[model samples]
Target: MTNASLTDAQLARSIALEAGALLQAIRARGDASGKALGDIGDREANTLIVARLREARPDDFILSEEALDDQARCAASRVWIVDPLDGTREYAEGIDDWAVHIGLAIDGRPRIGSVAVPARGAVHTTDDVHLPLPAAANPPRMVVSRSRAPEIAKTVALAMGTPMIAMGSAGAKAMAVVDGRAEIYLHDGGQYEWDNCAPAAVALASGLHASRIDGSPLVYNCADPLLPDLLICRPELAETVLAAIARAR
Candidate 1:
């Protein structure tokens, strides 16, 4: 794809906003019963977003959480990694923490990304756009899964002298840092590449630190495609957070 046609940032923002609208439509229907919300909404959102992407950028390949695993993406140097709805549980529960994530992986690294949180009426991007950074000395706040807060996360929060804020959706948690709603977002449990790619890209673009516990960078568009852990914190708190995770390990 030529750079002039659609910039990475522009594509990411477009996909994110479109998917977010789909998610909101599903939520408005109020069919949150027997996992109906998750099933119907996630599938619809995924299908619509993928279709839109294919139409918008036919030359580019895609790797999405809801689609069948495509080995073809592994060969493509530039691919779009997406999670149409990153927080099904929260969405089903009628919570506003769910988000739509769209990321572009160039050379196996998330180089451009966007996340849209409909409930919060917020859209985030990792482009040239500048969002004000939160105060550096503010007390660190750790965000973990509302349904599945791992003991390790709690332990690390205590070790870091911060409070643990229970939230839903990996993408939304990462955006909390971007919006200055929280200071840290960490998870050691299993997560797919689609789950982290867009949010990680946005965080990295916004000048935040996002990587593995050992401080390794997060890479996408891999064959295995499953990412088990992530650590996203403000730059000032990166060292301290990494040390805490190291001690816990």
Candidate 2:
């Protein structure tokens, strides 16, 4: 229960798992539905995560989707960028792909992180490198937003002759690549730091290449906190995917 006894990776995983578990409990109760369910999940999970982080790392800064932005985090060296209850809509609808994210950005780099898909009972973290990721499918598979697949993603998939699979949440799409359910996660739509930081950290540690779609490094803890797009994919496919993104754009 003490921060001194827990490594950053361990802390990230534990926090994410805890928040995911809380989310599961709330959903199981079924007192709310639609936006109400999402609101309750977001509020309760954020409260738990923020309180835990403050207690464990009092000096560290926090950036959470459900909490008010603290612009001061832009100046801090260690910032916990998190999505307390990612895929709120999916979660509201009882979808299995929604997740909880806990990420640490040290010196504007994703240093430690975890993403827990509670419904799927899977936790991917920077602490674990030996996860049995399935082999990449033939021609590769792409994971995208179920409601709005980016046109660039379509172009890339067409260029590679792969099938596109619709999914919910940025975390879910990124984890799909991390767990080997898919080979590519290209998001050109707008997103905030909380949306991708934790997922990026876990993906990078998993040996997948994670970066801005243009292949630039993903710098975090910025003043605006709006990261427009990112690409997470198999290492072997990073170059090809970046190139395709360039051509498509």
Using TM-score as the measure, which candidate wins? 2
Superposed model 2: Cα runs more than 4 Å off: 1-4, 131-134
Task: Put down candidate 1 lDDT per residue, 58-147, tens digits, no spaces.
Answer: 878899888898798888988999998898888888888999998889999988889999888888888757767968545678899988
- The TM-score values for the models, in the order shown, are 0.94, 0.96
- lDDT of each structure? 0.86, 0.90
Task: Identify the candidate with maximal lDDT.
Answer: 2
Q: What count of clashes does model 2 give?
A: 0
Task: Record all residue pairs in model 2 with backbone atoms less than 3 Å apart, i.e. clashing.
Answer: none
lDDT of 2 by residue, 12-106 (tens): 88888888988999999978999999999999999999998998888999999889998888889999999998898899998898999999999
Error of 2 at 79 (Å): 0.1
